[model samples]
Target: MDERLETLAQRTGQWLRTHGWRLATAESCTGGWIAETVTAIAGSSDWFDCGWVTYSNAAKARQLDVPATLIDAQGAVSEAVVAAMVRGALARSDAQVALAVSGIAGPTGGSPGKPVGTVCFAWGGPGAAVRTQTCRFAGDREQVRRQSVIHALEGLLQADTTAKSVP
Candidate 1:
């Protein structure tokens, strides 16, 4: 993991511990990198729940409860799937805060509309205060995944202020 990523994860862990909150992650294109970065911190188990690496479409549907219809309509990398992933992660875990990411970080997955490096993110918790966004990053597969991990941690740090539904 990158040093900056480690630092961000440390800060996020501290935030979770300070607020008595635990976090769960639902990941796709970045695999388990987001979970790996957070668990790298010592004592992360205090604020970190298990992570789900739902890389396959079936996994997203079966593991995250992302509707197969949604995946069929918008594919896996859309805002809808990512939002469902967040809800599923929070619902399935003891976590009060959660993040979800799905994207095309590839050398070959690019299309005219949804090109490579296009990542969708969702952050939320118990209620209806979810925030979702799509980011088009610049880089190769490794770099894009790295950026997604960094950005996900950055978002987690702000959950206290940004998520009205999270406690």
Candidate 2:
């Protein structure tokens, strides 16, 4: 695991604990790495709700309720799909904050438009709030996934901090 990611996860877990918010994750290519990183912290169970590894299109639809039509149209790696995944995770769990990821972190799943290191992420909470990002990383499968997890944790920390400062 990246030391930077570990630091981000520690900060995010502590921030969530401070704000009295819990988190859940819905993952595809990264396969729950974000969740694992957050839970790596001691007492994370206080702020970690659950995680779903929806690797397949069908599993995304079934587990996270990612719409079948959306996956068919967007191919499971688009901003729309990941936003839906985050919404679904928030809906299914007791967590107030959620992060979701879907991507092609591979040496074989590359396409002309969506390449091997393309990853999409979404983070949000209940009510009218959500944010999404897409990045074209450059690395092997493990590196890309690690980067994605780091970005996910960073986003969560940012969101938590911003929410706290709002009021």
What are the models' TM-scores? 0.92, 0.91
Give lDDT tens digits, candidate 2, residues 96-147.
9988888888988999999999998888865646788888899999889988
Error of 2 at 53 (Å): 0.3
lDDT of 2 at 47: 91
Clashes of 1: 0
lDDT of 1 by residue, 1-167 (tens): 66898899989988888889999999999999999999989899999988999999999989989899999999899888888899899889999998999999998798999999999888885554777778899989999999999888888666435333321
**Candidate 1: where are CA atoms >4 Å away?**
126-128, 159-167
lDDT of 2: 0.85
Q: What is the C-alpha RMSD of each candidate to the true structure, in Å?
A: 2.9, 3.9
